[model samples]
Target: MLAELINPYYLQVASFILINIILGVSIYITLSTGQLSLANAGFMGIGAYTSALLTLNFDLPIIGGILAGTLLAGVFGILIGIPTLRLQGVYLAIVTLGFGEVIRVIFVNWESMTKGAVGLSGIPHMGRELLNTLKEFGFDPKILGLQNNQFVFLAIFLILLGVTISIITFFRRQNRSRVGRAFAAIKLDEKAAESMGINITYYKVLAFAQGALVAGFAGALFAHVLAYISPADFAYHRAVEILIFAVFGGSEVIWGPVFGALFLTVMPEVLRFISEYRYMIYGLIIIIMMAVRPQGLIDVNILNWLKLKTSKRRQKHGTSSQKSM
Candidate 1:
């Protein structure tokens, strides 16, 4: 049972979970500012294609591709944000949804570059590429019993997940800062926020661009993990999936989306026994969640309650220790 759990397929699934976590956090950034942008998947496609092309055609290192892809996506985000941030509610969503379709169309038509719907395959795997580079630098993995490609991939995924979480922690901290307050104010009441001397446009655009950058980073990792990507991978449905990750988890806090992504990503695998009705059950679960807890599985109230419990436990433990002393 232990060996089965450690199999390559399971390792790959774990890598995918990490990728979805990044995606969830990315959408959470935009949702934090009350912007319902559906263009994240488009930005993701941009990152995936850019990285794949750079690595496959220009022979760029995986790290270099990742950075380039991330930055380019940010640039596109800024461009898109500036013009579209003026629109509110469904107007903004419709525009962004159109933007995603436009990106998909470009991917499909730009056959010379994107290979159209067929996708660009044979993109170098990050783990394999890193191992080869290490070998070149005289660091042999075979000596460490890391010869299996899956093990190497797992190691890389863990490192990336840690780094991603650390970065998210920083963002969470920033949420408590002035910028975060501004986001909250805007979310609560945009007119009031502006009346309070907040530059609504700047903050809105900033949030959108940040979300794009994060989504792009996730996409770069995703491309290498799958070693292939197509236009269909970043279509409207993909955008909805990313949104669900944030909405299902609760966008009030960063960890909400993380938990959402973790649960949703793994839930299907755990329910594979009922393969015929898996999707039906999945949809039912979501509908139930939406009806029961529209705010999400986690919210401010839950966090506060948990904090209170922890503090009470600590106080009790302190009193017991003092009495024993």
Candidate 2:
């Protein structure tokens, strides 16, 4: 009766929210360097297919597959970044977009490996695998009342979310370090950054590679969590959605993308009552947000103002208590 009262689908949605948060952070890392590359979806596809195949064929552990996928994507990022990172603005976007399409096409045509457009199924579930592994080590989940697969999955995702956030927090702090300043300088002005002894090419490529690595990690998790994948999963619009998460949330701070991902992922579900018009409303919200708060839903200025307001409120409350005394 207790289990029936709770919605299993909500847990699934929560898992997706966590996945999207990782995706949002991935693109923000690239955007931080001012490169408008759109190849994250491609990197994601590479990670998904690579990890899926490795696990399916070789019985590789989930962690092994994820690491393999991430490293492979990073290598591709470096290769693609070397030539394409030189371009700025829309030109880079166009190239990366093309790269994404090319990857989809490859996935579609590689029937022997990817099974063509039919997609791959029966990919190992991370939760199930972990559970089995634990059982092998004589550990029982029932001891903690986590015998349910859904709860196990949620637990794993929460751990991954926590770890990913910690890494992003570390990266955020790096913004004040020398490398962070170099990234900032390059974003501000490539020529000026180059003149300041900053290696524009190296830092730009580094940012791009890091973004790909992160996206690949997210993709690996996405594949296992859902246990199926297709070329369509990494389509052009998917890349656009990831970009919107960063833009709408305000990429100036790492938390901006995280907030953006959470809001956008949940908004549709919350508006399910108006399913037909939900998309229209969604479009309008984006248009309005772009028009009104071009800096995003969060930024340095907003954070500072929020801190000021909070401090002032605390001071006012203290003064009132003192007056009463």
Error of 2 at 151 (Å): 2.6
Q: What's the true lDDT of residue 228 in model 1?
A: 93
Give the winner by lDDT: 1
lDDT of 1: 0.88
Q: What's each prediction's TM-score? A: 0.93, 0.92
Q: Give model 2's TM-score versus the native structure.
A: 0.92
Please list the residue runs of candidate 1 whose C-alpha ends up more than 4 Å from where it truly belongs after superposition.
Answer: 1-6, 314-325
What lDDT tens digits, residue by residue, belong to model 1 across residues 54-123?
A: 9999999888999999999999999999999999988999999999899999999999999999999999
